[model samples]
Target: MIKSVWQGKKTFKAQSKFGHDIISDAPTESGGDDNGASPVELMLSGLAGCTGIDVTNIMKERLNDTTKFEITVDDEREDNTSRSVKYVNLIFDIEGEVDLKKLKRAIKLSVDKYCTVAHSLKATIEPKLIYNGNEEEL
Candidate 1:
């Protein structure tokens, strides 16, 4: 199981079962030292990383010569009252010689099947695929 310990005010040191530790801190204005990424930021990063990992493996197997890859996670948060995330969008920027259809399929597989973080999040996430420079709907 994963564990998170309060390191100090508005700061938490999260430990993974795999032996990795990451720090989460609120902004200085919120009482933290602003030393590390906030928990929400880490959550987004984790979601991106999960999908990225799946896509990378699929690329290798398909022999896709992808030169650049980036995932952007966008969402809105309700901070004042309920303090919850509403909607989320995942934009994939992929470059190089890759089959657009296969890339889209790979992404679908990631979000729909492989990426646990994607399914674990509370908000519904829409995956947008961009191949080369054109946006494609799958």
Candidate 2:
């Protein structure tokens, strides 16, 4: 298990000997120094990074020679709430001559089953994915 402790000011610092230090703070609107990424942004980014790694690894394992992998996540929030993410859309741009079928299947497996972050977030949010430069749904 992992544990963290925070002290004074808007800044809270976390450290693990095997991991990089983490710093969190309130947004400028909330009287913080705005020194780090907002919590919501970090959450979305975590999901994107996890799925991106899974997709890239799958492609590489298939000997697809994937050259580039980019994932962009956009979140929509409902009004008058605590700014929780209501919807998340992920766009994956993969560069290589990879089999579209395999790419899609890998992404589906990651988002629907393997990605713990995506799975946890899905309970309180709607998640969608776009794959391989296709405008069609995935």
- Per-candidate TM-scores read 0.80, 0.76
**In terms of TM-score, which candidate is strongest?**
1
Query: Which runs in model 1 stand beyond 4 Å of their true positions?
Result: 123-138
User: Model 2: which ten-residue window has the lowest total lDDT?
Assistant: 1-10
Residue 54 of model 2, lDDT score: 83
| Model 1 vs. true fold: TM | 0.80
The whole-model lDDT of each prediction reads 0.86, 0.78
Name the lDDT value of residue 22 in candidate 1: 93
Best by lDDT: 1
lDDT of 1 by residue, 1-138 (tens): 877888878888888899899999999998899979988889899999999999888767564576778899998888777667777789999788888898999999999998989888855668788799999997
Tens-place lDDT digits, model 2, residues 76-125? 99786587788999998878778889989989988987888998885665
